[model samples]
Each structure stands twice: as C-alpha cells, then as structure tokens.
Target: MIDTSMGLKDMSKRDILVNVAVLIGFIILCMGGGGIMGAITRNDFGDRSEWYKALIKPSFNPPNFLFGIVWPILYLLMAIAAFAVWTKTGLTKEPIPLVIFFIQLALNFIWTLIFGKAKDLLASLVEIIILWLFILLTIKKFWKVNRGAALCLAPYLAWVTLAVALNYKYWELNPNMKPDYSWFVLKTEL
Candidate 1:
C-alpha cells in the first residue's frame, strides 16, 4: 500500500511539472511569434531611434521603456490563463475558447506590425478593437473553465485598452507622420 501511494504521489508531481512546462512553452511561443512578425514587417529593423522619438505623444503616455517591462509579465499571465484552460478541459476539447485565445494573440502581433512597422495608425486602431473583442470572448470562455484563468487576462485587456487610446492620441497628434524607410539605414561605411 505504501509503495502504491508513493507511485501516485510521483505521478502527481510529474503531472504538475508537465503542466508548468507547457505553460512556459506557450508563453515563449507567443513572445517569439510577436518578435518574428515585428522583425519581418519592419523595413528598418532595429532603428526605432528615429520613428519613435519624432512622434508627438500625449502627456499621459507612459515612457516607451515601460512597454518593454509590462508586455512580458502580461504575456506570462496570458499563457498561465491558457494553460489553466488547457489542463482543465484538455487541449482538443476546448476548441472554441482556444481558437479565441489564438485569434487574440494573432491580433496582438498584427497590431505591432500595423502601427509600429507599417505606420498605419488607423488600421492598427481598428485591429486593436477586434483584438479587444476576441480577448473578451476568451475571458468569457476561460471563466467557464476556470475563473482564475479569466481573471488572469484582466491586466492584459486593460493594458490593450490603454494602448488603443495611446494609438488614437498619437494619430491625432501626428496625422501626417508616415514611417519613412530611409530613416532605417545605418551610417556605417560599406
């Protein structure tokens, strides 16, 4: 009986580890997807020095550096929420909610490509609205599986709402500011 109990405990521990590993992998995938999409869409690559600084931002805008800090934590939370749903219902069973989560994530990456790389502020704003809608749907579906998972998405949704407003404000302030590809060239001699 003691040996059986030990086996059960070990199995449970293994299950926990597997769940944690899956969650971390999902988060990393989301981050990597966004990074690659951003890199591919941007012509100038690492040269945000010119475009970002030249834009007229609202006084309420948070420092650009703050975005770097906030998104990783939010993405981790999003992954945890997704993992919680996956573990609760198994991956194949929760198709609708899982699809919603993926749709929102795709939109999240697309928004960066649209606004940051393409410099289409209006299109980005529209895309963010779609993202917000999908996020709401994901939250609702997650709530059905696990309330904690639903709650985990709250910060991400809030941040995106703030981002939408910021995008609009930037568009309003810099109506004519289109991204120029020439600004991306480095000064190094060939």
Candidate 2:
C-alpha cells in the first residue's frame, strides 16, 4: 500500500510539471505568432509622424505613439489569458473556445495587414468586427475554466471596439483614400 501511494504521488508531480510546461508553451506560441505577423506587416515609415499627417483623423483619436505602446501590452495580456485557459483545461477537450481564440488571432493579424500595409480602412473595419465577435465567444468559453482569463481579455475587446469605430470614421472621411506608397519617403523628409 505504501508503494502504491508513492507511485500515485509521483504521477501527480509529473502531471503538475507537464501542465506547467504546456502553459508556458502555449504562451510562447501565442506571442511568437503575433511577433511573426508584426514583422511581416511592419510599417516602413521611419518617422511615424507621417501617420499623424494623414488626411484628417477623428477628434477623439489617440496620439499615434500611443498605438505603439498599447498593442504590445495588449498582446502580452492576450497570451496570458490564453495560457490561463490552456493550464485549466488541455486544448483537446475545450476545442471550441481554443478554435475561437485562434480565429480571433488570425483576424487580428489580418487587420494589421489591411490597415497598416494595404491601407484598406473598410476591410480593416470589417475584420475588427469579426475579431470582436470571436473575442466575445472566447471569453465566454474561458470563463468556464478561469474567470480571470476571461476578464483579462476584456481590455482587448474594448480596444478593438474603439479601433472599429476609428476605422469606420477614417473610411467615412477618406472614401477615396488609397495606400500611400510614398509614406516611407515622406516620413524620411519629415
């Protein structure tokens, strides 16, 4: 009986290590995916002040530099939220929520490509709406396992909501706006 108890304790320790490793792996994957996408769609404009000069922004728009500060922190929070879900329940059982999280991540990257690279304001707006929906679904699912996980994503959802509205305003104001290939050069001049 003592031997059997020892075996069970060993098994429990192994399980705990495995779960911790898995959570770390998930967090790394989430951050790595976002990093790769950011690299691929990186803006070439050096001065970033060019972003400010673009047509006319909504009066409520945050300063351009704030975007740089906001996104990295938000991405980190999202990865932690995902890790929370993974640690609570392995990926296989709660497939639906995991899938929704991935869908939103894909949508999130697509918006970056559309707005930052392709400069398609309307397309980015549509993508953000889809991203918002997926985030809501993922939050609902994660809440079942870890309410903290779900709560962590709330700020991301709120930011996307603001982004969607901003995108809509830009599209409305600059109906004929196209991707400015000269942005890099103009930024250098500034």
Candidate 3:
C-alpha cells in the first residue's frame, strides 16, 4: 500500500545533500585555515615578493609567482582527501582518525605562521620536520579508512618535504638574518 519508490527517491536526495555538505565543509576548513593565517600575516604569500627576492635564497627556490599558483590547488586536493576519509569514518563518530587529521591541520597552520609570519628560519625548519611527520601519520591513518584519501595526501607530503629542504636552505643561507616584523607593520610618524 505504501509508496516505496517515493521513499527511495527521498533517501537518495538526502544522501546527495549530505555528501555535498561534507565536501563544502572540508573546503571551508582547508581553505579557510590558509586564508585566516594569510590574513594574520597580512597576505605575505602574495604581497612580499620584493622582501623575499631581497633575501639570499638557494638556487632551487622557485620563483615567487609559483607559490601563488600552487597553494590553492594543493589546498583543494587536501580538502577533498579529508572529506573522503571523513565520510568513511562517519563524521563525528570516529575520534582517533579525526584527531590525527586535525592535529596535522593545526600543525600546517603553525608552520605557515612560523615560516612566513615570524620569519624564524631555524625554528621553522625544525617545526616543518615535525609537521611532515604528522602529515605522514595522518596519511597512514587515512589509508586504513580510505585509500583514495591517503593518496590525496601524498602530494601534500611531497610538497612538505620540499618545503623542509627550502626551509633548511633559507636557514643555512642567512645565518645572521633576524626576524623583521617591521616589514609587516604600518608606521605613523607625526
């Protein structure tokens, strides 16, 4: 007597909505983290070409323009990967995997602050190694849940490895360089 076909249609629609919501949340979390950190640093990633160019850098350091192109794509991939895993883990129900995911994300933001904002090359180099480890751990945990999700983090891991090398190079090249917060601050003299 009941309308079984209608019930199935409603269920499919609900499932689709849930998937879309998860994807959107992941994007917001991933991109928003970068956005907030970049804002806190006054858009150093995009606006500091002159300052970065003046610094002594290694031969392998990519042109300043390359970063602006790469980061958004990486962030999007990362978000999709996390969402893939989260869906398998049942959102808030899976605690450990989610914890590892968040830990890595937090470390990611901290690395940006240390390297780009604080300009603490030596400290950032150390922190980046730790960040890389956490990322590896996150990927491992994600693999047990979803292989695709794990693969998504592979590029991120590779990029962080390069970042560690770059950080070390910056530290090695500029031994006596000091953190210059003045560059980011606005001065008002009467």
Candidate 4:
C-alpha cells in the first residue's frame, strides 16, 4: 500500500521522481532566496564595526569567524525545515508555518542591522529577543505538521540563545559605548 500519511500515494516511479524533483526545486529556490538575503546583509553591514571591535566581549563569546560559519549553515537548515513543512502541508493546506518562518527570517536580518550596522547593543538585544520568540513560534507551527522541520530549527534556536547572552553582556559591559542611533545617526552610519 502507498503511504498516504506522507501524502505520496501515487502511481508510477516516474511520477514519484518528478514529484521529488519538483520538491527539490522548491528547496533550491528557498535556499537561493535565503542566500540572497544573507549576501545582501553581509554586503550592507560588511564585518564587525569599529564600535563592535572596541566592545568588551565576554569570554564566552564566539569569534567573528564562528558567526561567519554558523549563519550560512543555519540559513541552509532553515530552508530545509521550510521545505519539509511545505511537503507536508503545501501552500494551500496550511500556510501559517511558512509565514512564521519568513517572519523569523526577516527578524534575523533586522537583528543583524541593529547589532552589526547600528552597533546598538541594547536595540539588538531587544530585536534578538523578538527574533528568538518568532523562531519558537515557527518551530511550534512546523511541529504541528512536520516534526523533522521543527527539529531542524533547534540549532538556529541555540545560536540565537548565544546571541542573546552576547548582546546582553556587551550592553552591560560597555555602558559607555552604546551609540545613540537616531535617524540622523543612522543616515550618517549608512
């Protein structure tokens, strides 16, 4: 008997292959979208700021190189997680998970802008906390339709946890360093 639970109750091997190919194509599209966003974030923000370099980071803080490595991997995992959920529910059946996923991803970009571009540790802390909650919501939404998709987000959650701590510590350690980023300051920074 075909596995209806998988939503793959179909006819021929050729059909299955084509369906899998389509799914793969979708996953690739998601990855590409994610990559483009990441590249834009990287190019726009482009490395640790002078303010960031001057901060008194906690000993627990990972190196700049580590973030460079982790973020791309996390982005890939996010794409895979979304792909898994899409395979289960499709665009019509339930779209909330995908919407939440995209929201969290956008929040991810915002956090980078606050932390990396503005160098506003306090604002970044707040934004990252919001991002963290969105990630939890996305994972919960994914869990309802696909457990593996939820599991894929675990690393992203963990990394954000580290970021929360780092943001808090930097804010705490260098009260002198918090840049007042008004619209004027933002324009100057840009």
TM-scores of the models, in the given order? Answer: 0.80, 0.78, 0.83, 0.77
lDDT of 4 by residue, 105-144 (tens): 8888777666765668788889999999999999999999
User: What is the Cα-based lDDT of residue 128 in candidate 4?
Assistant: 94
- The local distance difference test score of each candidate is 0.77, 0.73, 0.79, 0.76
- Candidate 2: clashing pairs of residues: none
Cα displacement (angstroms), candidate 1, residue 172, comes to 1.3
- Best model per TM-score: 3
lDDT of 1 at 30: 74
- Go through the candidates in order and give the clash count of each: 0, 0, 0, 0
Name the TM-score of candidate 4. 0.77
- Select the stronger candidate by lDDT from 1 and 4: 1
Candidate 3 residue pairs in backbone clash: none
Clash count in backbone of candidate 3:
0
Q: Which lDDT value does model 1 have at 140?
A: 95
Candidate scoring better on lDDT of 1 and 3: 3
Tens-place lDDT digits, model 3, residues 96-140: 776888888899899887777777888889999999999999988
Model 2 scores worst on lDDT over the 10 consecutive residues at 1-10
- The worst-scoring run of ten residues by lDDT in candidate 1 lies at 1-10
